[model samples]
Target: MSANIILFHSVLGLREHERHLAGKLGAAGHAVSLPDLYAGVATDDLEQGFAIKARIGWEVICQRARDALASTPGDTVLAGISMGAGVVASVWALRPLTAKVLLLHGLATVPANIRPGLPVQLHVADTDPFFPEPDVRAWQHAAEAAQTDVRIFRYPNSGHYFSDPALPDYNDTAAALLWQRVLAFLD
Candidate 1:
């Protein structure tokens, strides 16, 4: 069951990491779309990334995300990295038939209207500053309450964006495991 997937980039913008990931998914026989919400601007520093996001404005960013999904199927899988997870949440309710959600390095709200049994996979570092332990627990509980099938993978001692080799936070082992699980989930 190959899925049509729209993978959103992190606050750092649509860089090599996302393109590489999309290629990997494509190789696995899945249709992948990589959207550049930042309009070609990218930054490695978190603060600068947030500034870029702020300068573009949240509404515009989300509108771009929605626009990107316009060409895909309703059941297209929505995947995002870090701040991209929030982007997924923003547009989740609008796409009730989304096949599945893959949240990497962040957490997203489970919409009340989500289809029961819809699978959501979250991968984050245990001590990730962006996703504190308490918040992850709360998000999981909320998803469970919504009757959605949820799987949370916590990489102990890894960095927030541990899967991106371009960043200092990258963890080879954790990133490998994350991709393995993600591919299996898609299957």
Candidate 2:
């Protein structure tokens, strides 16, 4: 029951953190593709990451995402990190048969035409400045209302990118727990 997954990187672009995760997923028997939407550009600074994203333009980024997805199966699981979650949202409607969605460090709009019983998991810091509590709640409610099975895991006191060890925001405990849950979700 291994899943075919298309994992989009954050605004910071595809880096070691995402490659490591892809390797982990591959080791776990899942087929994973990590798309480099930012081309070869990458940054450690969040502001610089956003700047790169702005320079790349949203339409181009999304088009890259869509193009990356073209070779995968229709039921491939859609996963993302931070800004990548927005990428997932941008293409979700076009892939109505998506098996599952893994949203890390950010929230994406739940498609109004989502398939019933689709599974979606979200991992984010409880107090992440980028994702306010009210917004997360609203996103969850909307997904649930759309008949999707949604699970939200919030890590208290952890920073937004707690899962990436290379980042200053990394939290070992939270990252371990996140991977544990994510592995189970993929299973």
Q: Write the per-residue lDDT of candidate 2 for residues 1-187, one digit (tens) a residue.
A: 7999999999899998899999999999999999899999998999999999999999999999999999999999999999999999999989999999999998989888999999999999998999989999999999999999999999998999999999999999999999999999999
**How high is the lDDT of residue 126 in model 1?**
98
Flag regions of model 1 displaced more than 4 Å: none
Candidate 1 lDDT over 105-174, as tens digits, reads 9988888899999999999999999899999999999999998899999999799999999899999999
- Candidate 1 lDDT for residue 95: 97
In TM-score terms, candidate 1 sits at: 0.98
Q: What lDDT, from 0 to 1, does candidate 2 have?
A: 0.95
Return the top candidate by lDDT.
Answer: 2
Worst 10 residues of 1 by lDDT: 106-115
- What C-alpha lDDT does candidate 1 achieve relative to the native structure? 0.94
